[model samples]
Target: MEVNNRYITITNHIQGSAKESDFELKVVPLRLSVEPGSSAVILKNLWVSIDPYQLNRMKRYSSSHKTVQPAVRITPGQPIDSPGVARVLVSDDPEFVKDDLVEGFVHWGEYTVVKGGMLRKLDPEIDLPLSYHAGVLGMSGLTAYAGLFEICKAKKGDKVFVSAACGSVGNLVGQYAKLSGCYVVGCAGSRDKVALLKEKLGFDDAFNYKEETDLNSALARYFPDGIDIYFDNVGGEMLEAAVANMNTCGRVAACGAIAEYSEGAKRAAPNMVDVIYKRIKIQGFLAIDHMSLHSDFLSTTTDYIHNGKIKVQEDISSGVESIPSAFIGLFRGDNIGKKIVKIADE
Candidate 1:
C-alpha cells in the first residue's frame, strides 16, 4: 500500500546556528511493501534521536564529512537519517519480521525503508521503555560506554571530569565513572542541572560552567589534584582548560565538539607544551567505530538500569514536526539529557 510519508529536511545548507526556518517538512509517497527478494524493510518510526552532530551534517561544507563514511553531508530536501526505535511493517530480510521492534538508523519521518547493514532487531528480554532504545540503550549509551571504558580506560580512584555533563553521553559517562569507583565531577550550563547532576545522578560534584568567568580557574578549583580523565563533549576553551588542569599521563576522550558547531566558533587549541610534557592521550571517537563492544555495552547498561545503578535523563518532544525545534534546542542547552522526538505512539 502507498502512504504519504512526512519527513524533516533542510531547505539549504545551514552556515551557523540552525533556526527552525532552515528546516522544512516535506511529504512524499512511500510504499509499505518490499518487493519479493529485495532486502529492504519498511519501518514505522516511533522515537527519533535529536543530536547536535546533525548540524555539522547539515552544513554545506563540514570537516566532519571527511572523518567517516557515515558522517556524509546531508543534501537539502533529502530525508535525514537518524537513530530511532521503530516497528517493522514489512520485511524482506530474514532477520526481521512483521511487528518486530527495531532500533536502527531510520530517517526523520513517519516511516523508513532500509536495506543492508545498520538495522537490528531489539532484544525481547530487555523490558526497558522503547525510548531507552533510542537514547541511553542506543547510540548515546554505546558512545558513553566506549568512550569512557575503551578510549579513556577509566579506573578506580581516578578523578574524572565530564564537560556538558547534563547532556546525553556526558551524563552516562559520569555515572559509569562513578560506578567504576572513580570520583566524578560534571559541568553543566545551569544551577538546576548542576544540582540534578549531584543530587539525582550521583555525581560527586557538579558546577554550572556558564557561571564561571575563567574556565581554567574553574577546572583547577574542581580538580585540585588535577584531572586523571577528561571526557570532553564541549570543545573550545573547555578543552583547553581541561588539558591545562590534567595530571601527568592523563587521558582525554574527545567526544563531540558542540561548542565549535556554530559559525565562526573557534576550534579547540590545547597547549602543545602541556600535551607533550604531561603525555596526555587525547583521542576522538565515534560510536559506530566501536560496534565490537555492542553486546557488552548493552548487557552492562541493561544491568545498571535494572539495578538502579544508573539514572536516565531524557527530554522528549512530541510528534515528527517537533524534530527541528528539538534538534535546535541542543545547541541552546535547552535539553537536560537526551533530546528525543516521538513520531508516533505504539
Candidate 2:
C-alpha cells in the first residue's frame, strides 16, 4: 500500500531561537512494504518526542554533530528524525515482524522506513501507554536514570539540586534523587512548574528561577549546607550558581545546556577556582553512551511507575501538524514535563 506521509522539515538552518515559521509540513508518498530480502522496516509513526536538543541539530553548525550520532545536523527539506514510538507495518528484518511495537529513531511524519538497526521491539504485553515509549519510559527516562545514578552517583542523605527541574529529564532526575533518599531541590522557569516539581514530582523543595534576582543567593537559601549533587540542565548562569553553592567533593552531572542552545547565548562559566577548591567532579554525558544501563533503568523505572513511587508528567499534543509548535514551546518553557506529539493512534 502507498500512503501520503505528512512530515515536518526546516526551511533552512536555524542559528538563533527557532520560530514556527522556520518549519514546514511536507507530504510525500510512502510505500508500506519492504523489498524482498531487504532489511528495511516500515513503521506507522505514533508518538514523537519534542525536545530542546533537537534545535541544536537544526543549526548550520553544531558541536552535537561531533558528539552523538543522533545529533547530526538536519538538512533543509529532509524529514526530521526524532526519538519516537511506532507500530511496524511491514518488516524484512527477522527481529521485527508485522504489528510489532517499537521505539527508536523515527521521522516526524505519519510513517517511516528504516533499514534495520536503531529500532527496538517493545514487549507487546507491557501494560503502559504507548506514548510513554516516546518520552518517560524511553529516552527521557534513560537520560535521567543514567545521569543521576551513573554520572552523579546519587546516594542517601545527599543534597541534590536540579536545574530546569520541570523539564523532561530534569523532573525525572529530581524524582529519582528523592527515591534515592536524597534531599532534592529543583528550579523551574514558572511558579506552576515549580509547584509541580514540589507537589507532584516529590521534590523536597522547588523555586521559580524567573522570580529570583540572584541565582547564587537563591541556591544558598535553598541549600544552606551546600549541594552534594548538581544536575545541570539549564547551563549558563544557573550552572555558575550551582557550582558556587556546591559542597566539597560535589558531583555535577551535565546532562544538557538548554540555555546555551540559541545563538550568542552565554556559555556556562562556572568558577574554576570554586570547582578546584571544592573538588567538584563535573562530567558531561549523553544517554546513548550509557546503553549498558538500559535494562536496569527500564526495569527499575517501570517498577517505580507501577508502584506509584514516581509521578509521570507528560504534556502531549495531538497530530503530526503540531510538531513544530510543540518543539518551539520547549525553548519558551511552555511545557511542564516530557513534551510529545501524538501522530497516530495505536
Candidate 3:
C-alpha cells in the first residue's frame, strides 16, 4: 500500500538560534513494500527524540568541532533524521521482519525507509516504556553511563556535580552517582527542575542556576570541598564555575555544550589556570564511541529502573508537527528529562 508520510525538513541553513519557522512539514508518498531480497525495511516511527545536538546539524557546514559536528549536514529541502523508536511495517531484510519493533537513526517523519545500518530489535519481554529506547534506554542513557562511569571515572564518596542536571543524560548521571554512594549535586534552569532533581531523582542537593547571581559561589555552597567529578552538559559559565571549584585531580566529563551551539565564535572561555593548578582531567566523548559498554549500561540501568532504584522523567510532545517546537525547546530549557515527540502508537 502507498501512504502519505509527513516529515519535517529544514527551510534553510540556520545561522543563529533555531526557530519553528526554520522547519517545514512536508508530505511524500511512501511505498509500504520494498523489492524482494532488498536489504531494506519500512519503518513507522513511534517516537522521535528532540536533542540539542541536532541543532548543530541545522547549521551550514564550517569548521569541524569534535563535540558538535552533524552526522549529516541537513539540506534545505530534505527530511532531517534522528535516533528514534520505530516499528517495521514491511521488511526485505532477514534480520528484521514485519511488526518487529526496532530502534535506530530514523527521519522526523511518520514513515521512513531504512536501507542499511545496524538497527537493534527491541525486546518485548523487557517491561518498560518503548519511548525510553529513544531516551534513557537509547543514546541518552548510554551517554550518561559512559560519560559518568567511563569518562569521569566517578567513584563512591566522590563529590559529583552535574550541569543541566535534570536533562536526559544529566538526570541519569546524578542518579547513577548516588547509587554508587557519591554526594551528588545538580544545577538546573528553574525551581521546578531543581525540585525534580532533589526530590524525584534523589540528587543530594539541587540548585537553580538562573536564580544564582554568582555561579562560582553557588558551586562553592554545593560542594564546600570542591567537586571531585563534573559531568558537564551546559558548558560555558557553568563549566568555568565548576572548574574554579574543582578539587585536585578532578575528572571532568564533557558531554555537551548547549550554551555554545548558537553562539558561534562567542563561546564560553573556561579558566585554564584552574585546570593547570588543580591538575584536572577533562575528557569529551561521544556515546557512539563507547558502544562496547552498551551491554553493561543496558543491564545495569534497566535493573535500576525495574528495581525502583532509578527514576526517569520524559517530556513528551504529541504529533509529528510538534517536532520543530520540541527541538527548539531544548535551548530554552523547556524540557525536564528526555524530550521526545510521539508520532504514533504501537
Candidate 4:
C-alpha cells in the first residue's frame, strides 16, 4: 500500500531563535508495507515529542564553541525525527507485529518506515495514555531517573533545586526527588507553571524565575541552608546562582542548557571559588549513555504513576502541521509541561 505522508523538515540550518518559518511540511509517497523478509516495520506515528535539545541539531556546521552538535543534524529537504509513539502498520521484524504499539526514534510525519536501532514494543495493557510513552515513560523520564539517581546520588532529606521545574525532565526530577523524601523546589518561567509544580507535581515549593529580579538572591531565599542537589536544566544565570548557593559536597546534574540553545552559547560562568570552597561536583550526562538503567526506570516510574505518586502533564497540539509551532513554543516557554504533537489517534 502506498500513501501520501506529510512530514516536517527544516528549510535551512537554523540560526539563533527558531521560528515556525524555519520548518516546512512536505508530502511524499510513503510505502505502508514492509518488503518481504526484510527486518523493517512501517509505523503510523501517534504522538511526537518536541524537545528543546532538537534545536542543537538544526544548526549549521560550525567550528565555533557556541554551536551545539545534535546527535543527528536535520539535512535540508529531509524529515526531522524525534522520539515518538507509533503503531505498527506492517512489520517484517520478529520483535514487532501489526497493530503493536512501539516507541523509538520516529520522524515528524504521518507514517514512517524504520529499519533498525532501538525500537521497543509498548505494553498495550498499560493503563496510562500511549502519549505518555513519548514523555514521562520515554526519554525525558529516563533522563530524570539517570541524572537524579546516578549522577546526583540524591538521598533522603537532601535539599533539591530543579531549574525548568515544569518542563518534561525537570518536573519528573522534582517529583522523583520528593519521592526520595527530599525537599524539592522548582523554578519555572511563568506563574502557572510554578503553581503546577507545587500543586500538581507535589514539589515542596516553586517559584517563577521570570519574576525574579535577582536569581542569586532568590536562590538564597529559597535555600537558606544551601542546596544539596541541583538539577541544572536551564544553565545560564540559574547555574551561577545554584553554584553560589550550593552546600558543601553538593552534586550538580547538568542535564541541559535550554537558555544557551537560542541565546548563542551564553553559558553561565560559575564561580570557581565557590566550587573549590564548597567542593561541589558537577557532571553532564546523556540519557542514551545510561540505557542500562532503562528497565529500572520504566518499572519504578510506572509504579509511581499507578500509585498517584507521579503526575504527568502534556501540552499537546493536534496534527503534523502543528509540529513547527509546537516546537517553536518550547523556547518561548509556551508549554506548561511536556510539549507533544499528535499526528493520529490510536
Candidate 5:
C-alpha cells in the first residue's frame, strides 16, 4: 500500500522572526514499500513539539554567514523535524509494527518515513495525554532529568534555581527539584508566569525577570543563602547572574540557551569572578549524550506523575496548520508549559 504525506516545510531562508510565509504546507506522494536494501517505517504523526531549540535551525545563518550559527541547521525546503509522537502505520523492520505509538525525530507532517534508532514506542499504561509523550515524557522530560539530576548532581535541601521557569523543560526541572527536597526558585519573563510558577507549579519562590531591574538583586532576595545548584535554560545575562549568586562549590547544568539561539556571536555575560571565588562547577550537556539513561528518566518521571509528586502542563494547539502560530508564540513567552501541536488523534 502507498502512504500520503502532508506537512509543514520551510518556504525560504529566514533573516529575522519566522512568518507563515517561511513555512509552506506541502504534500509528498509517499510510497510505503521499502526497497530491498532499506528498512524504513511509516508513521502517522499525532503531536509535535514546538521547542526553542528549533529556532536555531531555521536560519540560513551559519558560521560562514552573518546570522545565527547552526548548532542544528534546517534547510529552507525541508520538513521541520523535532522530537515528535506518532503511531506506526507500517514497518519493514522487526523492531516496529503497525499501530505502535512512538516518539522520535519525526517531521512536521501527518505521515513520516523514518529509519531505525529514531522512533520509540510509547508506554501505554502511563495514563499520560498523547502530547505529554512528546513533551514531558519525551525530549523535554529527558532534558530536565539529565540537566538537573545527572549533570548537576543535586542533593537534598540544596537551593536550586531554574531560568525560563514556565516553559516545558523549566517547569519539570523546578518540580523535580521540589520533589527531591530542594529549595526551588524560578525566574520567568512575566508576572503571570511567576504566579503560575509559585501557585500552579509549586516552586518555593518565583520572580518576574522582566520586572527585576537588577537580576543580581533579585537573586540575592530569592536566594538569601545563595544558590547551590543552577539549571540553566536561558543563558546570557541570567547565566551570568546565576553564577554570581552561587554558593561555595555550587553546580550549574548548562542546558539550552534560547536567548542566544537567534543571536550571532558568543558574547560573554558579566561576572566570571564568581566561578573562581565560589569554586563553582558548570557543565554543558547534550541530552543526546545521555540517551542511555532514558529508561531511568522515564521510570523516575513516570513514578512521580503516577504518585502525584509531579504535575505536567501541556499547551496544546490542535491541527498541523497551527504549527507556525505555536512556534512563533514561543519566542514571545506565550506558552505556559509544554507547547505541542496536535496534528491528529488515534
Candidate 6:
C-alpha cells in the first residue's frame, strides 16, 4: 500500500485577475521512499515563498527563447510551485542524510522528491527565524544584492532611484545605496509606504505614485539634476519617465517588471531614443545570471544584519491554502514587504 500525500495544484491559466478558486487542493496515494540509487531526496516542506516572478511561468511564453527549466511545465491540474525551504526526511546521495534541513525547488506540497543540485544545506546555528531563509537571506536577498550592487554599480554620492521602493528588494536596495553614500529616492503605490521608505528605510526622498498625475514631473522634482542610477522594478510608465530623466552616462538595472505581471501589458515601449539622447545604460538582469555571487551575497548580508547596518521586513501568511490570497495581494499592492506563505511552521 502507498502513502497518501496532500498538495496544491493549479486549475487553469488565469488570464485576468487571479482568484483563489483557480487552485485545487488534493490528496493522493504515492510512495514516499527514496533509495540509495535513486539520486533523489525526500523532503518535508517547512516554508514556501510566493514571488512576482512566478506569474511569468503561469502564462504562455510568447518568445522563442527556451524557458528556464524548459522541461518543467506548469499545466492545469499540476502542483503549483516555486522555490521553498524544507527538511530532508530521506536521502540517497552521500552529500545529504536523513533529518538534514534544506532549501530549494520545493513546491506547494508538504513533501517533495528532487535531485541534489536542486537543494542546499541551511545553517542551523544562526538563531534567526528559519522562515527568514525563505526570504531575506534567501532568493529575495540575493535578488536585491545582485540587482542593486552588481547590475547598477552604484557609486558613492551618486543619485539612485528605486521603483516599488517599499518592496523586499527595493527596501534593501535603498538601504544599500545609502550605505554606499548615494542620495536615494523611492516611489511607492501608497502614502504609508512612501512614509516608511523615508522614515524607516532611510531613503533621502520618497513619494506616492498614486498621488502623482505626472510621473515625469514628479521625477523631475525629486531628481532635479537627473538620476545617476535607477534600480527599476515596476516597468511600465515608470521606466519611460525615469529614462526620460536620466543624466549623461546614467546606469539602470532592470530588476523586474512587476507592474506588468498582472496586467501583462507593455506601456513603456523601449525608449532607446532616450538612451541615445542621454547616453544612458539600462540593462535587464536575472539573479540566476550571477549565481556565483550567491555565497558572497549571503555572507555580506549576514554581516550587515549582525552589525545592525541593514534590516529586512516580511509579510508572511500562514498555511498552504493562503497562497492564492497572498499572491493575489501583490497585484493590488496589498503587501507591505516581502510576501511569503508558511506551508508548515515546524
**lDDT (C-alpha) at residue 42 in model 1:** 93
Could you tell which candidate, 2 or 5, scores higher by lDDT? 2
Tens-place lDDT per residue, model 3, 198-301, is: 88899999999999999999899989999999999988888888999999999999999888888453565678988998999989889999999998999898
Error of 6 at 218 (Å): 0.5
Best model number under lDDT: 1
> All models: lDDT?
0.94, 0.92, 0.89, 0.90, 0.84, 0.81
Please provide, for model 2 over 1-346, each residue's C-alpha lDDT reduced to its tens digit, 9 standing for 90 to 100.
8899999999999979999889999999887878889999999999999989898999999978887779999999998889999998999998988899999999998998898559998876668899888988899999999999999889999999999898999999999999999999999989899878878888999999989999999999999999999999988999999999999999999989999999999998999999999999999999999999998998898889999998999999999899999999999999989999999888
lDDT of 1 by residue, 87-136 (tens): 99999999999999999899998999898848889999999999999999
Error of 5 at 66 (Å): 17
Worst 10 residues of 3 by lDDT: 62-71
| Clashes by residue pair, model 1 | none
TM-score of 3: 0.96
Instruction: Locate the minimum summed-lDDT window of 10 residues in model 4.
Output: 61-70
lDDT, candidate 6, 1-346, per-residue tens:
3665677777876665667887777777757777658788877788888777766666555231254662244777776667788888777878888888876778777777677556788877666778778888887788888887888788898899999888878888898889889999999999999988888878999999999999999999999989999899988899999988888898889888887766547666657988998888889877777889988988887888888888777888887777778888888888888888888767
Which regions in candidate 6 have their CA more than 4 angstroms from the true location?
1-3, 62-65, 70-73
lDDT by residue (tens digit), candidate 4, 249-277: 99999998999787467779999999999
Error of 3 at 277 (Å): 2.5
| TM-scores for every candidate against the unseen true structure | 0.99, 0.99, 0.96, 0.96, 0.93, 0.94
lDDT of 4 at 132: 97
User: How many clashes does each candidate structure show, in the order listed?
Assistant: 0, 0, 0, 0, 0, 0
Q: What is the descending lDDT order?
A: 1, 2, 4, 3, 5, 6
* Residue 50, model 4: Cα distance from true site in angstroms: 0.7
Q: Which pairs clash in model 2?
A: none
